[model samples]
Target: MTKDIEQRLKNKDINPTAMRLLVLDFLMQQNAAISLTDLEKGMGPSDRITLYRTLKTFEEKGLVHHIDDGTGTTKYALCMEECDADHHHDLHVHFYCQQCKETFCLPNTQIPEITLPKKFRSEEMNLVIKGVCDQCNPD
Candidate 1:
């Protein structure tokens, strides 16, 4: 976990602190993407404001990407490419399980490009597919 945090910090060219390390470790431990609530639950006694600030910093540094699954919850996943402290890879699909309500990152799946009206600029795009996950299906 420590190594993972160090690697992420180094990749983002940021000096990792204890809180950052802990947050990064928690994110790395998850098999799926997670929300701020999930992070708070995982951290136990962590301060909410502190966690939010940490997440904001990580997002700004491009160590994480925010994914809105359209369930009134925002989740985050680690960037696939070696993103710089200011850039991120925003073209990926997120999977949300209806039964478990957990979100997973579809790493190999790429989000299709959509043509927008003229003069429209797209900085980021999120595509979420909701259904019962394999674990929930099990049939």
Candidate 2:
């Protein structure tokens, strides 16, 4: 598992330092997108600044992508393998469960291409749907 984590980091051209390795491994185990505060809690005694920097580096390297689910806090999730430093291909819809307060990546649902006005340019795009998740409904 450690080797796999290291390889993932290397594939993104990120150095697999001890802190990075631990952060990536932890992210891999998550079932939902996580906020920096939640990550700090989960890491247990790790420096918040280091973790934030690690997350920022991962985002820049395309190893992860941050989402704003309208909760006023950014959440991070692992990007698909096709993502790289130059481009991110995980342009999928995100779901935020109101009941559980968890955010999820809906990779199977791709965002449709939008044709903007001639002078306009798009830097980034995000769509979030808020509802109760399956675990919270279970009916």
Candidate 3:
């Protein structure tokens, strides 16, 4: 499992240090995006600064993408295989479950292209749908 995680980091051009491997392993086990605080809590006894740096490196390498679901806290999740340091093909809709307060990446739901004004340039795009998720929906 550790070897697999190391290979994934290397694929993204990220150095697979001990801490990086540990961080990536933890991220892989998560079913939903997680905030820095949540990651720190889950890592138990880990240095907050080190964890934050690891996450930042992953983001820069396109190994992960951070989501701003309007919850005032940034959450992170793994990026698709097509993502790289130069470009991130993560223009997919994110879902925020109100009941569980968890954010998930709906990778299959691609965001439609929008025509902007001639002088307008788009750098990044994010769309978050807030509602009850399948797990939280009683019906």
Candidate 4:
């Protein structure tokens, strides 16, 4: 498991240090997008600064992508296989559960392409569907 995690980091062009390996492994184990708080609760009693740095590095390297799902906190999830250091092809819909405050990447749901005004230019885009997820929905 550790070897696989290390290899993933290396594949992303990131140095696979011990702390990076540990954080990447933990992130891979999660089923949903997570916040720094979630990671701290799940993977720590580990170093807070190291963990933050690891997450920042991953985001910069396109190993992961973050969603500002309007939950008052940013959530992060693993990027798709095609993501790389140059560009992230993560134009998928994000589902944000209001009750549980968990975010999920809906990989099958592609974001619709938009045509901007002639003077406008666009780069990154995120489409988040906010609702009560199955886990939080009672009905």
Candidate 5:
């Protein structure tokens, strides 16, 4: 697993330092978007400043993308294989569980293509549906 993480870091032109490897490994293992608070707690005895920097670097390199689901806090998840340092193609629907307060990426359900009005420019788009998650709603 460590070797795989190292190779992935190299592929992104990022140095696989101890901290970077740890952060990347954690992100790779998660199925939902995680906030810094959660990451810090999950990563015990880690340097907060270094961890923040590592996450920032990953975001810049497109290894991960931030999800601003109107929570006033940003969550991050591993980007899809289609993403790169220059381009991010991880524009899928995000689900925020109101009960658990967790964020999930619904990659199978894509965002509908839209043609905007003339002179109206759009840069980035994020659609997050808020509700109880499957785990929270045991029906």
Candidate 6:
């Protein structure tokens, strides 16, 4: 796990610190996106301030992308590209299951393009689709 984190950070030109490595390892372990609180809980009793700073650094380096699902909780997922700082891949849709409240990335589904008003520049996009997941649906 540590090796995986190291490789990911090295690929992104990010120096892998202990905290950052642990955080990235945790994120990689998850099958879906995770919230800050979830990450903290997974990391045991680490300092909240440090975690926040680490997350901020990761976001700036494009190691992770934020996902706001309108659930009042911001989730994050690992970025697919090492040098994707300027080009975020959040254009993909996210599936949020209402029953389990888990968010899964719909890898094959691409987000439709939306025209912006004049003089407006779009940097990144966040599209979340809410419904029941297979585990929750059980059908």
Q: Which of the predicted structures, 5 or 6, would earn the higher TM-score when compared with the native?
A: 5
User: Which sections of candidate 6 miss by over 4 Å?
Assistant: none
Off by over 4 Å in 4: none
Model 3 TM-score, 2 decimals: 0.98
CA lDDT, every model vs. true structure: 0.84, 0.97, 0.95, 0.89, 0.90, 0.83
lDDT of residue 77 for candidate 3: 98
The digit string of per-residue lDDT tens for model 3 on 3-122 reads 899999989888899989988999999999999999999999999999999999999999999999999999999999999998999899999999999999999999999999999999
User: Could you give candidate 2's per-residue lDDT for residues 18-106 as a string of tens digits?
Assistant: 99999999999999999999999999999999999999999999999999999999999999999999999999999999999999999
TM-score of each: 0.91, 0.98, 0.98, 0.93, 0.94, 0.90
Residue 24 accuracy (lDDT) in model 1: 88
lDDT of 4 by residue, 70-105 (tens): 878888899997898789998999998878878999
* Clash pairs (backbone) in predicted model 3: none
Give the clashing pairs for model 1: none
* Residue 3 miss distance in model 5 (angstroms): 0.8
Report residue 13 deviation for candidate 3 (angstroms).
1.4
Off by over 4 Å in 2: none
Ranked candidates, highest TM-score first = 3, 2, 5, 4, 1, 6
Q: What is the C-alpha RMSD of each candidate to the true structure, in Å?
A: 1.6, 0.7, 0.7, 1.2, 1.1, 1.6
Error of 1 at 95 (Å): 0.8
lDDT of 2 at 31: 99
Report how far residue 39 has shifted in candidate 4, in Å.
0.9
Candidate 4 differs from the real structure by a C-alpha RMSD in angstroms, to one decimal, of 1.2
TM-score of 4: 0.93
Looking at model 2, the pairs that clash are: none
Q: Which stretches of candidate 5 lie over 4 Å from their true place?
A: none
